[model samples]
Target: MATYDPFRDLERLASSFLETGRRGPREMPMDLYRAGDHYVLSTDLPGIDPGSVDIDVDGQLLTIRAERTLTTDDSAQWITRERTGGTFLRQLSLGQGLDTERITASYNNGVLNVTIPVSEKAKPRKIEITTQDGQQQIESTTA
Candidate 1:
């Protein structure tokens, strides 16, 4: 019995040319979401050298680039090649409230993790309310 996996087949057929040792620019799949006072981004880039990863920030644009190489002997024969080796590029538009100066990135076990912290101005804060007697009191905390 065989189970069907269209996604797996689609992904392989999509970038099969890279298996032939052709270099190309590909999008690195990522997940970005807010966690507490910061945002976390995780992308998959398996079989890539850590030193080949390049991260840069230009204005409010964050760019990430990396390369994966497949080295083999000249007489090597590939019966079922599926892994891709090429340059992976991705860019993100940072919002005005996000802190761009304190961004950090790390790679471990084929996954790249990036942390984007929220700025002080964008953080939620509580404001004091004034009563009719000119007395300041706590209104409520803002989320």
Candidate 2:
């Protein structure tokens, strides 16, 4: 006879729940990284129409909402349903150092790319400093 660990089962159940939650409309996998003078956000939105996708930036929060409709009609008996097709809204909190007015977004193929320019005050600047020996040193500044 083998003993079952309740804690282990609980952990597995929790993990399964979390994985299912990630498939919801508001849940999306995203990649945000700094690129030159702006921050780029790349997200996967397969089977989504470009026109049905909406992207907006409010304050320090960026919101992306997309709708996908899928219809299937079979002439057989009733079956189980596991696929979800509807509107999904995903919101992410960006840094306040971004320039919301200058934000740019584009959708190609099935990927959505958002480029948010960093504010001038947030961008690194070269500050020249004069030393006692008449030497100059460059420093970077941030907002």
Candidate 3:
């Protein structure tokens, strides 16, 4: 049993008209996770041209923008067209420990992958301990 909601269809119609090439467009779906010393973010932008994708970082904010357009022929009609083409936007707030300068992004198979490396200063390191009295020597490796 499926519920018929007229508002949902109206909302979808409004969104298709509202989204433009500018900002405030619909955002692409994504999944972010941490892997070892880096964080990986994967976003889905199906049927989008690779040249239309853009990634920019300012301060601690990372913004990803892309556009998809629906191409049609006048002869083809009388069918359902659910895939609305519009701009996609996504922003991420980076943390202090992230290495923003070396962030890399790649697009393949309609998916965009962004890798953010962790800063070296934030990684675990061994600290040496020593005695100031000059009579005792202590050597320890703490990871």
Best model number under TM-score: 1
For model 2, residues 104-137, the per-residue Cα lDDT tens digits are 8998887889998988877776676787998877
Model 3, stretches more than 4 Å misplaced? 1-24, 133-143
Ranking by lDDT: 1, 3, 2
Local lDDT at 37 for model 3:
95
* TM-score of candidate 3 versus the correct structure, residues matched by position: 0.79
Candidate order by TM-score, decreasing, is: 1, 3, 2
- What residue pairs clash in candidate 1, if any at all? none
The list of candidate 1 runs beyond 4 A from truth reads 1-22, 131-134, 138-143
Model 1: per-residue lDDT, tens digit, 48-67?
99999999999999999999
Better of 1 and 2 by lDDT: 1
Pick by lDDT: 1 or 3, better one: 1
Evaluated with lDDT, which candidate comes out highest?
A: 1
Error of 1 at 46 (Å): 0.9
Distance from true location, Cα of 91 in model 2, Å: 0.8
Least accurate stretch of 10 residues (summed lDDT) in model 3?
15-24
lDDT digits (tens) for residues 1-143 of candidate 3: 99999999899777655553334578889999999999999999999999999999999999999989888788988355667677889999998988999999999999999999999988877665667865546666554
